[model samples]
Target: MEISQYSAEQIATLQAKLEKKLGPEYISTRPGPGGGPKLTYAEGWKIINLANEVFGFNGWSSSITNLTIDFIDVHGENPPRYNVGVHCITRITLRDGAYHEDIGYGTAENVKQKAAAIDKCKKEAVTDALKRTLRSFGNLLGNCLYDKTYTEQVKNIKLPPVRSSTLLLDVL
Candidate 1:
């Protein structure tokens, strides 16, 4: 992945805006191994929206550069399965003469029993690749979702104190 065109300050500003836009609703908890809490990620629509806000509508474009499928051995009593891998390249142009390109890879398995397995795998691969490519832009769009340790750290991070009266007034 290429380095981000945006500077640190610009990325920080974008991160703050994204945090405000995506509130607690974007975060979810799941059951991890040993009955521990696990962090779940929201969809990538927010990232796309933020990218559009930061850059113009045509600032970024993603397309599948390559795709391949490999057939695996069929197991007993199971349908034949194939592994599909997709390579996606995304280009983000913040402005004239300022741009970056990033490549992301995604793989998914599809079984013959499933109808439209190839299509489903392709969609999953595309989404995964997009998420990975977007995450290359640092934490602006909740990149912590890809990092377990960072997710835990974020959970422990303290929020600024809020005035109770201000909250009450807003509610009233």
Candidate 2:
């Protein structure tokens, strides 16, 4: 959506705040499949907290517009094992009417229960899509992790935590 609806000064100030480097405290690394390189990211809750920090708790919202099973494979008959994959698209809308959307995928492998696998994959997919869509906002939302150089420079720089009570007061 067009940010033109917002005043230039308002947009610039918001953009600058969002563009600031995300402190390393919000970042985490997890082991990747096949013992490959570790995956670095901010947890889903961190993204939600960052949104509240930058946009105000009531300033933005996200919705899952689409969700579907990308693939399902069931095999091994004894207890029945299955693999599932899910895809979802999420939209993030600012109170001002500007918006962004992105798709995310999740997979559950070798699970013994189909229903549980689907549930797990769906939640994972939606969370991934929410984070991906929100990342469009700016670096604090995760856009910087995509930039290896910038990430390398600030990867270890941690900032003090943003207390939710302080944020709530700001909303008042």
TM-score winner: 2
lDDT of 2 by residue, 4-114 (tens): 666888788899999886778878878888999877788999999999988889989999899999999998999999899999999999988889999999899899999
RMSD to native for every prediction? 7.8, 4.3
Which stretches of model 1 miss by more than 4 angstroms? 1-23, 29-39, 72-115, 147-149, 153-172
Q: What tens-digit string does per-residue lDDT give for candidate 1 at 67-105?
A: 554333333355566545555555544543354455555
Clashing pairs in 1: none
How good is model 2 by TM-score?
A: 0.85
After superposition, which runs of candidate 2 have C-alpha atoms over 4 Å from their true positions? 1-5, 156-172
